[model samples]
Target: MLHQPAAPVGKDPAQQYKMRLGVWMVIAYSLFYGGFVAINLLKPLLMEKTVLAGLNLATVYGFALIIVALLQALVYDAMCRAQEHKLSDQKIAGEVR
Candidate 1:
């Protein structure tokens, strides 16, 4: 016996938008992360200095990176969902006409 997918997978109309959005987001995140690496490479001692709440620069920056990543993921998801919804509505409206 052969099994089939529950629903047919159609090509995403939001593919291009999603790809562009994703690439931009990745580049933004990479630039932010690169700063951390630059600091470590140029001034290793700077990481030991307390920046906030008695947390060292490295610790604070590391935590901030994690938070930023999570925030970016959420924002990306919201934007993609909105784009997909808008495109889907347009497709439906087109079908009705």
Candidate 2:
């Protein structure tokens, strides 16, 4: 069963915080990705150099970017979940008192 939040949805401070966090995360990703793309375009030869036996710098960097994005998403999700849990606990405590 979905427990009703004790606070109003629109005005929840935690929700607002989460929204800002998510927006900033997106902006950060954009900057990081834009830099990567810019580097690739500016120095094609640098990106093409083989870093490992079968992987070039471009391929490695591309994979790293994907991993970074995935990690950021996981972190954001965890942070939101933590905030939600905190809110839930506060509501439960209010009911008990």
Candidate 3:
């Protein structure tokens, strides 16, 4: 009879962090999308004529999205740095073994 190797037990911290990050990304995306939809739905009612610089609703939305994307990128970068630090600490302490 051939015996297969058993699956490894216990969760790795790095893997756990990755999973958490994925969940957070999903949540963030959902919220972003939902907010976008809500704003679009209420745009006509909320939109106001701007005399300053002559910016329209569409332009405002575009700028808002660009800002959101930049902020999200920064947030993701910080999260990645935190995860890297955690992994490095674990490596130094020999927790990965």
TM-score of each: 0.90, 0.74, 0.58
After superposing candidate 1, which stretches have Cα over 4 Å from the reference? 1-8
Candidate 3: residue 23 Cα off by (Å): 2.4
- lDDT of each residue in 1-97, candidate 3, tens digit only: 2454486455455676767886887688778667767867876655454624888655676677778778877887788778878887978789656
Clashing pairs in 2: none
Global lDDT of each candidate: 0.97, 0.87, 0.71
For model 3, give the RMSD to the true fold: 6.2
On TM-score, the stronger of 1 and 2 is 1
After superposition, the stretches of candidate 2 with alpha carbons farther than 4 Å from their true spots are 1-13
Best lDDT among the predictions, by candidate number: 1
Which regions in candidate 3 have their CA more than 4 angstroms from the true location?
1-13, 48-54, 95-97
lDDT of 1 by residue, 1-97 (tens): 1565587778899999999999999999999999999999999999999999999999999999999999999999999999999999999999999
- Model 1 has how many clashing residue pairs? 0
- TM-score of model 2 vs. true structure: 0.74
Error of 1 at 60 (Å): 0.5
Q: Give per-residue CA lDDT, model 2, range 1-97, as digits (tens).
A: 3776786455454788799999999999999899788987898788888898789988988998999999999999999989988987898899999
